[model samples]
Target: MMTRVVVIGAGPAGLVAAIRLAEGGARVALLNKGTGGLQLGQGTLDILGYGPDRVERPLDALAGFAEAHPGHPYGVLPADLVARSANYLRDLVGPALLVGDAASNLQLPTAVGAVRPTALASPSMTAGACVDGARFVIVGLRQLKDFYPELVVGNLVRTDLPGGGRLQARAAMLDLPAREGEIDSTGLTYARALDDPAYRKRFAQAVKAVVEPGETVGLPAVLGLDDHNAWSEVAEAIGAPVFEIPLPPPSVPGMRLNRALTARAKAAGVRVVPGSKVTGFRASGGAVDSVQLATAGGDRDFVADAFVLATGGFESGALTADSYHNVHESVFDLPLRRPEGHLVHGDYWGDPQPLFTIGVEVDEQMLVRHPGGDPVYTNLYAAGGILAGATRWQEKSGEGIAVASAVRAADSILAAAATATDQGAAS
Candidate 1:
């Protein structure tokens, strides 16, 4: 008999866990309340970008980072597992699509032209790495209101790279051929238009005319949505190396990543249940039997042999706070580990707030633990932002922790299932 597992949330963690479970021969059901965070995030995988200071070597810094911050998710996650998870995600997303590794952090230019460090990035953004003597022409479409090439160039010219480099950047704006009744276009519209081979050729010509010698072209991340080759095609047409600068929320690169992972999950035989909010769950004898989902008619129960909760933190409503500053986990009402005194203090963006560090505690195996360090449910595990200690945004370890913990949780479930089969045979 196949082991049935239910994974909650559709973020990177949940999707990864579901895919691993299904690939391990388990019947997996992935549930999500709404869309995942990928659409609002950069497609790059950030693994420990900062350890108080900028981290050049992410894998090498893991042990020190874990020691500095006790009870952090990295404290339990082995470095080898973290490295393996990076490879696993790259393989799952396809080597040709996702590039980079955990060995070193790449300083990629953000939408504002400020440097952002990431361990893994798409091929479209790899050429944008801010290195010594790197010259760039930040290009923007006149019709695209989201991107500002002048602003990007202004920032890039003043900013210094993490690895001791200065940037020389210029700005250019070109008018793209407008469709019927179209004056301004969203990233999606521009992405779809670029998918056409003919449109890409014309677009490349326009970009090439504005480019100078020894300057790599930097365009807004609207190259393609459905087509991954759009960036390369444009680069080929322009006859120059080009890279993408990710735009604000509702990101095209992010959408491409989400679509790719979701598609891979489905292809791995995982059943995806979308738009279902998990309101409650049934647990007894320290094991979860089923979870309740809110429906149009009424609440429905989803039964499974095991469960993995990857529901995001405060951002996704998985964790909420009341007027008195009492925070609570939405689904299981699990206990949270919060800092003493005020939950938040100091500047909003300066120092990491204590409140942001509050989350459910999990064992090394990714199982949620009670206040006294006992598993709440033997068959339940937690991953991603929900099981937190370090402030992910502060450290830039969000994707790394999510992927590694999800892999650990799925591996634990598979091992448990195998042990059960062996016990049954022995009996």
Candidate 2:
């Protein structure tokens, strides 16, 4: 009999876990409330962004991170597993990203022209890498709101280059081909326009006219919606290397990953249930027997051999706080580890913010546990931001934690299934 697993939350962690379990010969179902963090992120994998400062060799620096913060997800999880998960992501979302040279972080620029640390990025986004002999032309569309060419130019000119060389920077505005009397336009709107091959040709010409010879051109992440090769085709037509700079929240680059991964999951025979709100579960003995998801018709019950709670932290509303500010882990009602006394809520850079790390307490096998240290359910596990102890935004370790913890949970369930089969055969 195949091992059955239900993974809640459709973010990178949940998606990865579902795919991994199915690949491991398990029947899997991925349930989610809504489109997840990928829409809000750059869609690039950030392993460990700032280890106080930017990390060059991510794999090597993790050793120090583990030593410093023993209870942190990375600290407790095996380093080899983390590395393996990264490779899994790289392989799963092929062509949507350009993973940096092994063992090192991909230093890529953001929308603001300031570079940040990431593990892998699409080739278009990777063009922001400050390579030798690379001069930059930052182009902003006048139609595009929330994008300032001058501000981007100012930051790019003054910002530190990764390769430690002086390069010239210039800014230009592209009057992107658009219909007249258009009320408002967003990145997605612009991307749809570019999807028309004729419009894209005209758009590429406008960019080509402005770009100087041998200068790599940078633009907002609105390239194409249906076509993944829009940026590359434009680059080839314009005779310059064009790359995308990830914009503000509801990031386009992130959307690309979400679409690709969801498509892949469905193709792999994984049933993906969207808008699924997990209200509760039924437990028997020491394991979860069934999960309940609320619906307009009524509550639906799903029985599985193993379960994974990848419902993200507060930002995703998987974890909520009451009027008295007492935090609650909404699903499974698992015990959360938070500061006992007054939490440091100040906006200071180095202050220990208690709110960020309040999440489900889990044991080494990725199984949920009580505050006093007993497993809440042997078959129930957790992965991603819902597992406590690391401030992901500051550390830039969100993807790393999600992928690593997910792989951990999947492996644990597979091992448990194998053991059960062996015992049953002997009996």
Candidate 3:
């Protein structure tokens, strides 16, 4: 019989875990309460951007990073596993769609013109990698209210490029294809408009008119919605290298990535059940036998041989804090490892709050562990934001932790299944 696994949450960690399990010949069911947190991100995978300072080479810094932060998720995972996890995601998303390797971090510009270090980025944003003496023409759509080319340029011109030197930047505003009566639009709306070939051609012409010689074009990340080739097509039409600057929520690039991964999971024979919240579970013999999902009609039970919890941290309500400042894990009520004393500090921008680092403790195999150092449940594993100890926002290691931990959990389950099958054959 096929090994059955139930993965909770639909975020990057859960989705990747489900896909990996299915690929390992397990019947996987991915359950989620709603859309995952991908749409709220930049869609770039950041391994280790900063270790107090900017990290130029993430892979090279992994060992020291892990040693310095022994409580972090990377401490339990091998650096090679982290590298393999990133490669797996790059391959799964197709090399063309998701570019870059673990060799070094790309310095990409954000909407606010701040340079962010990321290990893997889409082709649409890779060209904008910050370099010394680089010239940029930031283009903004008049209809898109979210982006301001002037603001981006103003910040870029003031900020020094990584490694050394400075940047030369200018702002340009162009009207997106005129809407019937709409004056203001969103990133998604602009992306849909750019999906049309004629519209992209006209838009490219408008950009071309403003761009100067030897200048790379930077635009809000709204190149395309349904068309994955829209960015390349626009670049071709303009006869210049164009890159995208990620905006706030409702990010087009994030949506594109989420769509691609979800589709790939389906294609891998993973059963994806969205809007299904796991309310409870049935456990016995030191293992989780099944999980119950809240349904419209009634509570539904999903039986599985193993389970994975990647419901995320405070942002996703997987970890909650009470008025007294005591934190609790929502599902399974697992014990969380917290800081020594105060969770929060007075400085908002100085250092990450201790509260953000609180999460369930997991063993080397990604299985949730008891305070005494034993597995809480033999069949239950945890990954992603829920298995913390790192200040992800401060370190820029959220995506890396998610992918690496998910891969670890899935591989452990697969290895156990293979061993069981071999033993039965021998018997």
* Reference-based lDDT, each prediction: 0.90, 0.83, 0.89
**TM-score per candidate, chains pooled:** 0.98, 0.96, 0.98
Q: In candidate 1, which residue ranges exceed 4 Å CA deviation?
A: none
Per residue, candidate 2 scores C-alpha lDDT tens digits across 36-125 of 778888878888877777787887889898788756888667678888888888889886554554367877767776778888778787
Q: Write the per-residue lDDT of candidate 1 for residues 268-331, one digit (tens) a residue.
A: 9998989979999999888999999998889989999999999989999999999899999999
Report backbone clashes per prediction. 0, 1, 0
lDDT of 1 at 2: 83
Consecutive 10-residue window with the lowest summed lDDT within model 2: 95-104
Between the candidate structures 2 and 3, which one is better when assessed by TM-score? 3
Which 10-residue window of candidate 1 scores lowest in summed lDDT? 175-184
Residue-level lDDT tens digits of model 3 in 82-194: 99999999999886568998769999988888889999998999989888888899999888877899888898888877788888899999866445567888888888888
State how far residue 74 of model 2 sits from its true place (Å).
0.3
What's the lDDT of the predicted structure labeled candidate 1? 0.90
